[model samples]
Target: MRILVTGGAGFIGSALVRRLIAHTDHEVLVYDKLTYAGVLSSLEPVASSNRYSFVQADVCDAEAVAKALREFKPDVVAHLAAESHVDRSIDGPGEFIQTNMVGTFVMLNQALGYWRGLDEAAKARFRFHHISTDEVFGSLGEEGFFTETTPYDPRSPYSASKAGSDHLVRAWGHTYGLPVLVTNCSNNYGPYHFPEKLIPLIIIRALNGEPLPVYGDGSNVRDWLFVDDHARALQAVFETGTPGETYNVGGNAERKNIEVVTAICSILDRLRPKAEGKYADQITYVTDRPGHDHRYAIDASKIRADLGWTPSVTFEEGIERTVVWYLENQAWWQAILDARYATQRLGVA
Candidate 1:
């Protein structure tokens, strides 16, 4: 099958593209805007392969998207393009609204038009899979988990925009009979993740012996999913998932913010310890994010039962592997840190 995947240079997207190119017989065309977090190096493994291609265009550009659709004539359109950083969204919301909301609107319309032009059998096999986040379900209480049926209660600008996009995808499927599948996933950590996110940021800062900043006592909790697991879940859904259905993908690995940071510190202590004191000595508490949700936990039973998919790695194993990857592959991330973003944060001053 021929697949068109947007945001295929970002962490999870690149993982998916590599899996498709290496493991499956599908031809993949990556449509990515190549923002600060989106690095070409992430897709380097599959770039030399005949099955993978890339487009340097924005999802909001109707002309570019429409042209790509017509030329690629994809059997599956995997939508993963968006303004993904929550803190960045807090700093500058206009871009998130434009990309996550309006961008999705444009992509949906273009995909619908392309789907209508396909022949009968080809049209029946076509799929539009929208990748989303569990953050759109807002903060969780002490118990209970977010399921596919969870209501939208986004607190931050990023989550709100993603929620809007998810609604639009469902509306297009219900209103126009478009064959669409939406999956809302938890936090993903793995190789090629941008330094802006918590896991990578801590690892890089720890390596440099810089102060490791923790937010507001760092008790905020989130379910952690490995990026590779998410990519596999996406492929499973794109291939066999029923149209107009929603799935929740999670690692079932929930950890508090402080625990996540501390765990990284422990891993670095073993792998790349400081000369003098322990890595945890560098920990510092900072102000919390504005409008930050308290917690997010995912109920992945639906996908597990239906798709027969579960997280393949324990958070400990995944984090250790990720740390080793960063330790050994300094060149890949250094280029991104030096050229694209200087490791200074934008959303926080």
Candidate 2:
């Protein structure tokens, strides 16, 4: 199948693109806006392949989206573009609303038109897979997990915008008879992750002998899905999932925020030990961001049962691999720090 992946230059999107190019027979076209988070170098592995192509454009631009649809003529439109950082969302929400909410609307409208023009077989084969977050279900207490039937209670600007987009996708499917699939996934971490996120930030800062910042009490819990595993789950969903259905993808590995940070420290201490002390010594707690969710966990049984997709990497294995990747590929992240963000704190509001 020919797939057009929006936001394919970003972390998870790029991972999906690489997976498609390397592991599958599908041709790929990446449509990205090159936002600060979108790094072209992430696609370096598959850029040389004749089956891999890229178009630098925004999902909010209807004409550009339509042009890509018309030219690429993709069998699947995997929508992954959005402003995804929670802290950044707290700092500035307008961008999230515009990109995550309005951008999805534009994509759906264009996709609906494109699907309408296709023949019966082509239309039947087409899919608009909306990739989303488990945060859309808001915070969990301690025991229960978020299922496909969980009610949305988005607390942050980022999750709220994503929740709106998810609703829009389902609306398109229900109202227009468009073939749409939605997947709400847990937190993703792995190779080529933007440095601003927790795992990468801790790794980069710890490597530089800088303080590793933890928010509030550092007890916030999150389910950690490896990006490569997530890319695989995406493939499973779009390739075989039922249209108008939602799948919850997870790593089945839960850890507190402090645990996540210290785990990174442990890995670094083993691989690149400090001369005198442990990397965990640099850990410091700071004020938490506004409307911070206490916990998020996904009930991935539906996906596992229906599509036979499960996370292939455990937290320990995935984290160690991630730390090693950063250590060996300093040039990749150093270029990012040199050009854009410097691992500073955000979302102070």
Q: What is the clash count for each candidate, in the order shown? A: 0, 0
After superposition, the stretches of candidate 1 with alpha carbons farther than 4 Å from their true spots are 341-349
TM-score for predicted model 1 compared with the true structure: 0.97
lDDT of 2 by residue, 237-326 (tens): 999999999999999999999999999999999999999999999999998878889999999999999999989999999999999999
Q: Tens digits of per-residue lDDT for model 1 on 1-349?
A: 9999999998889999999999999999999998876899889899899889999999999999999999999999999999899999999999999999999999999999999999999999999999999999999988999988877899999999999999999999999999999999999999999988999999999999899999898999999988999999999999999999999999999999999999999999898878899989989999989987888899999888998999999999999999999999999978877775444555422
| Alpha-carbon lDDT of model 1 | 0.93
What TM-score goes with each of the models? 0.97, 0.97
**Pairs of residues clashing in candidate 1:** none
